[model samples]
Target: MLGEERASATRIRLLRDVGMLFESADVGWLLSERGAATSPSLDELYRGLVRALTDLAALPPCETDSGDLPASAYARVPDVAREVCDVLRVLLGRLAGAEAQAASSPASARAVVRALAAPLCVFAATHVQEQPWSSPESRSAASQLLEAAVRASGSVSVAEFLCGGTPSGEQPGALSAVLRLLRPQMTKESWKRNQATKFVFSWILTRVGRPWLADHLDHVFASSLLISDDYRTENKVLGVKCLQHIVVNVPAADLRQYNRAQVLYHALYNHLYTPEAQLVEVVLPCLLDLLSVLEKPCGSTEMTRRTNRYDQVLRLVLTHMEMEYKLALRRVYARNLAVFAHRMGVVMIRHLKRLERVIVGYLEVSDSPGEQSRLSILDVLEVVLQNTWPRVQSRLGALVRALLKLMCDVTADSGLCSPVAREELLDKATRCLLLLDRYSEGQIRA
Candidate 1:
């Protein structure tokens, strides 16, 4: 190891040389270094290990290098990697130990963990998919080490470390290989039982983005589905978020391949049955984005289907709004319902009867002093009038009655609505009334 006074570059070069030696050394030499009293310091050791594994990872295996290769030939190549794994195992243990003391010295422990995290994660990402470590036992160890390291360093740092470096763009396939190592830990049981594991999987899904994710759809989809299928609300939310990222970043054609889009559609649609307000709030926007990808409009075969994706979602959303009584959730439903109405375009007329009921009912009830639910419902009303004005004429009486009553309620509840909010509500209600009058050709009374 270089003295503290030595230049950092000199020390890095020395450690890198030690790493290069591992690339060609025998098992006996590797073992001797592992046991030597003059072993490198943690920083030097990690630097050396990463350098060695990175070289090995870049090597293409010989054509004859099968598992059946003579033990002598195979041992010489993988032994170096095995020794590095040994050193890493100890390093991971140290990180876990430091984290255990976090309560007493959070800043100090965090510094230690962060210092070692990126390099170790780089090592894992490098050789985790190469020969020897790609085996189940080796990969499991690598995944556990990753979980602990990421938990200690926090997801943001580890994600940046893995995805931000120079090699990410140059060797994206290598980066995607890291996903295979992480899969065991992102299983349904692990996702539900381990919050940190879920975070790791979810963050990776977003952080890696489209480039690396495009070639690795199976891993991305499986982990996301497992998270979504979990019983925990937080896990489900993470799953939804991951799904959203996938929907946006992955090619629409690829997502549609092999009924993958249908699988995602059913998964999100089922979540609407959930009573969890938080889950529903996220699911609606994601569903909206995904519906566009899953279905193409304008005389496509999808339009020929008996029930299209938009109608399926709208029917379910209206069903929830009709039965829902919680003001917070009603706000969520009303807010999203407006977008659905707009996206549905003139086709929104098909759901008019049920949509009219939800709009009227939502306006009648006060939700908070802000009247967010009623305001959102009013937006829905305007969208309805704008898109389906001719059909709205028959429903003007019911709609007008609701709007007048809402304005009266907003006016009467002076204490509930701040002056600003009250005026805003009144203004929006009056505008809806104007649209109603225009649609009615002055046939409607105030």
Candidate 2:
């Protein structure tokens, strides 16, 4: 049996050889070293080589003799690249451990977190599909490392991260590197597209004119599958909500030049017609939010040859004004329609009597929507009537009369079985009518 002393010496000698090779900066040797360290006695040597390669990767951009080599050349080989990531999980643990000792080594702790950004990103992006699943321990370790890095670099707020931008104080090249690796990971069911939208959102959330950074910016946000293209694999609800978040974060004028942008506005347009009731609640408000941001007279010949995606944008919303199937979806339908009418202002509501009818129809006693759902629809009604009161004034006389009659009836059913639930529903309806009456000049029409 090899004594512990002998194993330690063997580990030391093998590590020296690995160090010398790294000094030469000839990456071709990493494969050979990993292959040679298979013997149980030399297990530490394999671990050493992994760390050495990670350090080599995280070093500031060095000018090696291989000028012709692509920046991504090291990762082009799948086997070698994957070993680097396996080692990366180890480094993440160390970084977390160091950061945990805040009083002892703060500067060194911060440095590890900062230097780690590039290597972690590069390893994550390399042939990710071909890589073996990182063990549970490794996954937990990586998460800890990320949290530590985020804590150390307090420059980026949590909100900014969701918008697809890095923390404020990050070095430019490192920030771009991180986003590139983050893009393809967001489409899985756990796409966290809610937070996932940030990888791209950070780029154009402000007005972007940098053509040099355009390629990176485009890859991360404008062309990402999670936006609307990768619906085949993504959870549509999560993706739509993330899309809504990005729309909120993106600056108006910066995203304006292309309001009907493919997969941006175009994707939402396509989803509206598809029978996904789940998306009805979220996508409609976002579509209207988008129109409020768009340049006027979209797609006209006089405009800058715009895709006029906004034309489809308006046409689609006006066409599908209601969702009649589920109580929850109907409530969502009312909410989205109200927000749209309110945002478009009276000029729009005054012209589209059909929209007002769609918004008001959810209140009918015969539809029988659930108690909680009915209350939610009422809340939307109050906002819609409040925001569009001037336009709705002359139009909703008979509807007001029906609401008054519903208030006086003691046996209102609307499909709710529990008496307590029915009471709650009626209470909500009464409040909605009162708010509508507030703006009715003390005499509701009819």
lDDT of every predicted structure (CA atoms): 0.68, 0.48
324-369: candidate 1 lDDT, tens digit per residue: 9998899999999988877777788888999999998898888767
Which one is best on lDDT?
1
Determine the backbone clash count of candidate 2: 6
Pairing residues by index, what is the TM-score of model 2? 0.55
lDDT of 2 by residue, 362-431 (tens): 5553334344444555555666566567765676575576566655542654444456656765686677
The positional error of residue 180 in candidate 1, measured at the CA in angstroms, is 3.3
Per TM-score, the best of the predicted structures is: 1
After superposition, candidate 1 runs with Cα above 4 Å error: 1-174, 189-194, 298-306
Clash count for candidate 1 is: 0
Please give the lDDT score for candidate 1: 0.68
